[model samples]
Target: MARHVARPDPRAHWVLLLLGLVTLLAALSFHGLVSAVGGGSGPDQAPASPAPRAVTTGGPVLRLDGPTPVSRRLPARTLALTFDDGPDPRWTPQILDVLRRHHAHATFFVVGSRVDEHPELVRRILAEGHEIGSHTFTHVDLTAAPGWRAGAELSWTRNAIAGVTGREVTLFRPPFSSTTAAMTEAQYEALRNAAGSGHVAVLADRDAKDWQRPGVPAIVKAATPQGGAGAVVLMHDGGGDRGQTVAALDQLLTRLGTQGYTFTTVSAGIGAPDSMVTATTGARLSGTALRWAQTGADWLTSAMNLLLGVALVLGVVRLAVQVACAQRHVRRVRRPRRRLPEVVAPVSVIVPAYNEAANIAATVRSLVASAYPALEVIVVDDGSSDGTADIVERMRLRGVRVIRQANAGKPAALNTGIRAARADLLVLVDGDTVFQPDTVYRLVQGFADPTVGAISGNTKVANRRRLLGRWQHLEYVIGFNLDRRMYDVLECMPTIPGAIGAFRREVLFAVGGVPADTLAEDTDLTMKVLRAGWRVVYEEGAIAWTEAPSSLRQLWRQRYRWCYGTMQAMWKHRHALREPGAGGKLGRRGLPYLAVFQIVLPLAAPAVDVFALYGLLFLPWSQLALAWLGLLLLQAGTAAYALRLDRERFGPLWTLPLQQLVYRQVMYLVVVQSVVTAVVGNRLRWQRMVRTGEAAALVGGAPAR
Candidate 1:
């Protein structure tokens, strides 16, 4: 008996990994690492008490900590140019170029997140003899945020600038703030809080309103101070398109120079010390680490988006191909054909049993009840502790025989049955499967063509009254059978499926019988036959009903084995890629398709789900909901079409959406575990599902005896 050995569950490790990824993405969004899509912060509109007359009428630079506020005006013939919402990669450099050409200096109020992204720009600003100030991390409105958040915003921005330039800034600018006269009470409180931390508030004397992207001429007029009163001018170097800002800066500099106004940094205009001061060693190191961490987060976000886009495109293409090929296959099979001799070859049915006493009686009975005249059934019981062989023997059905053997596993028992059989055509089936009376007869019809070597029969779920069973039924109809039809049309059918498939006796022996190397013996055998120049095809008219796992644990084990075995078989036959004829077609077409849709897609599915959650939480809900609904409708439409093709009722498909939440996740994890096991080179034994004998009852037979 192939018993399962206890091993550490890898689910905890994968779950933790997925959670970590989601957390990182959420953190990135919260911090605003990516640029905003629409525009800069809107103008502040909340009503509040006006500032004191002395402060409002005072110069742009103010020291508000004392009982009486102290302020300073810019020197005569001087203009203090300060840019906010930077260091943008696109517009900042152009503004810097204009300033460099005019030999002018300005203070850049940098957002901490943007500084993390373009640290080199911050360094460039410092190296070029300009000034830097804190614009608050993420460009958040300090007046609207909590006091703690406002404090952290200022601290984070200072650290970011210190990381790049080895300096800390004493000057601060609140997001969406204007001239002192326009300041609200909340804004003043925020400024007072910053003053307590040694930050001097830097309000603008002139509002260029350049972020509005008015014509270049309008921006220039708004920025030019009245009568060279030595005023502080505000503008933008970030936000949306700054073409007007850049053009206005160049023209403003030239036009203002003719008016005898010299542009300089904020501190220089006020005759104060430079706003930037050298930072302590500890701050610099921690800030540098923060910079690198944010950079990595940005890269990860971009890579994930690219991967999701690619997966979406591939998924759509796969669906389109499946529908097209399935339709083609239907037309080809239904077209009228010339009359030919019916195939009545004697057939041997092989049933490999391991602890399958619960299902053996019905399996044997179904075989004996086949309508075909020349049929022999061989039940090979492989060391079953349960009385599997005895159950079949007690039935005493005509043309049925039972052979007992030690537990050498499924492939060895299958080979034993083949050698003892007395017919030229063979049908392979699992012990838990129940067949219709005409299944074997219809299965052999493909043998009428001399070149056809094997046939794959359609497999259905026999215990689909429960939700789990219904989910499996949907998968069988949409995911499996539909793909089989497509594969048949493409002439690259990979596996004939052990639940129900037919093979030629000679073809089996020529390909060295059932392969023992992989757990999926049927797939291994089918590939061997294809490599030997025999065409394997699907016989949809022949159907077998098999028991699907009722519990999640059982489903996980079954799917893990299947996925791992298929991967092994694909690897074992990898040389077919270089071979000529049918082998090449299987390699070039079938293997890649399986790798992308089966292996790679499942591996990527969890990450996609994580991203979808991220979108729901941080992104626009309406857009995300519409996108999810569109995908659901596409899947439901495909499932409906597949069910129609299989002559199944549409009632099972109502559970399809629910399956995405539960069953689909289980399948994804199965692929994950299988891939990890394969990569680690661990050996997986045969996992037998406990049979309920429900399949027999579905076909009008008695339950387990």
Candidate 2:
């Protein structure tokens, strides 16, 4: 007898949200496994789980079987000879030939890199009648992962397959078949979710144990039907040493054929099948023993998905509001009346250096050359083993003062400079950055209004010729520019960015100088300033160009630090959450905007991801069409905004879909990591960003003011 799966409660929305979060956490943890191994796929013919509904009322098949049981009893006699961790030139073709001779179809769960390396093989697989499944970008296990890494494995794998075969792969077979039942449930749902609204059906039984290199006779013997007629068999053609699999399958097919058996594709046997089982609830039912169980599961899943969706949406809306708040506050500033204050007030420029021997002199030189009349350049050398102070002293830069301090972090260094500042206005610059000739003037322009507490400058990528550099350049242009504009409109500038920013000396003191422990001291200060009801402004023309990471390793480290720091900032300001008038200037505008842009948007991203992967994998033309339409509109809107900003790069814009393959996961990582760090009170000491060969040299080229 088929057992009835217990249903979840209708009001279990919170549970669903928790489940979603758990799934997200699982995805992050299983990232390496998914990337290095693969995820599992649902039955190819299994229609996409219906779109979320208030009460889905179609088929009466309400008996929920455990996933493993469902996979075992799928009413198809055809075998899905799925070989994971492959695209190997040496062995895949041999297996393909054997399948061809028997006129049999199989599924190949291909790794992303292999697909790229051997596109022709992928093309051949698709053309020859075998279905393709994602073995992750590099055969990663998606069951025990968290953050961007998990999302990357799923998304990148899908994208690579799509690129090679032009087919949207819906099924993912996890490598090693290693996920526990609980882990599988979370991972399958998350991958489905990350794929954008698709359901993944995991295989129940493994017939041919090929990964172990069992002898050909053992392989054939294992696959020979032992239980009832219908069964889904698994075989391998990848992940090393498959010659035995090739020989075994040939003999198995011949044996099955001689036994008066016929081979059929999984879909061919099931798609549009005549007989169908309908499970229905009786009309007189008032939450019966069975009815309750059916509705319970539906209710639980629905509530959870809905709540998570709501939380994600709310977070994004908050960020948007924050951006809008910043803009409004900046626009509220009255026009400057007097020219340069006649007897120009002295503005102190603080340069924070820690072993910045290669670039400190240039930074000091830029400050000394600043067109602002009465400017003091204070270089704080934070215990550098290198002659950073010596270089500053050797330059003999006029109006520049060098201060030696112990090896303190950026925030500490900033505080030292702030305390020593002899002027009323203070500007903090990283030692590795350079400023435009008019940077200081522009930074100080916003100080005309007494209500303005701090000013942030426009930051740009100085080196963008390399591929990685171009990618970073595009990121700065689109992400930062959009975020800044939105923040300006919202009125809460998260931080007067440290690269080139100014604050009133008194205002700095009011906010208690720079925060020493937070990785993003700049952001914390900006939030604190807003929480105090003061405004932060952006000087768009005040350009400061800094070197972006030039390689993947450097890029990863830099981003990890940034994401970790941003999480820290969010935690410190979490008091603003839903509190009436809790955020001061930011609460009213900035906090709300940021919640929308940063928090909600990323969470919502999985929705888009689920919808997209569903459409592609299941070939649901209608749903796919709708999702694709939405995606097109989103791109159109983003592109228009990018164009309006004059920062449009045709290549990045064109690769939007592909970029999303990796981009969404990156955002998800930031979100997941932030949440975890918040809960654990994770503390991170600042790690200096690595600057590779040319990147190191290019730091010297930034134009001194």
The Cα RMSD of model 2 versus the native structure comes to 21.1
Highest TM-score model number = 1
Candidate 1: lDDT over CA atoms?
0.86
Q: What lDDT tens digits, residue by residue, belong to model 2 across residues 97-136? A: 9889988877776786566556788878878877776666
Off by over 4 Å in 1: 1-16, 19-34, 37-41, 44-46, 49-58, 64-70, 75-77, 100-103, 214-228, 247-260, 701-705
lDDT per residue for candidate 1 within 1-705, as digits (tens), equals 899999777576677767876676675565343444223546656556877778788888888788878888897779989998888899999999999999999998888888888888998998898998888877877877898888888887888888888998999988888888787777788898999888999998888888877799888888887866788888988877888999999999998898888888999888888778899887788778878777776776677789999998998999999999999999988997557569898999999999998777877888888999899999999999989988888888889889999999999999999999999999999999988899999999899888889999999888887899899888998988999999888888999999999999999999999999998788888889888988989888898989999899899989999999999999999988898888988988888998998899898888778777767766788998899889999999999999999988888778987999998999998898899889878899889888887886855642221
lDDT of each: 0.86, 0.63
- What are the runs in model 2 whose C-alpha is more than 4 Å off? 1-343, 575-583, 600-611, 619-626, 629-633, 646-652, 693-705
Decoy 1 TM-score against native: 0.92
How much is the lDDT of residue 343 in candidate 2?
A: 25
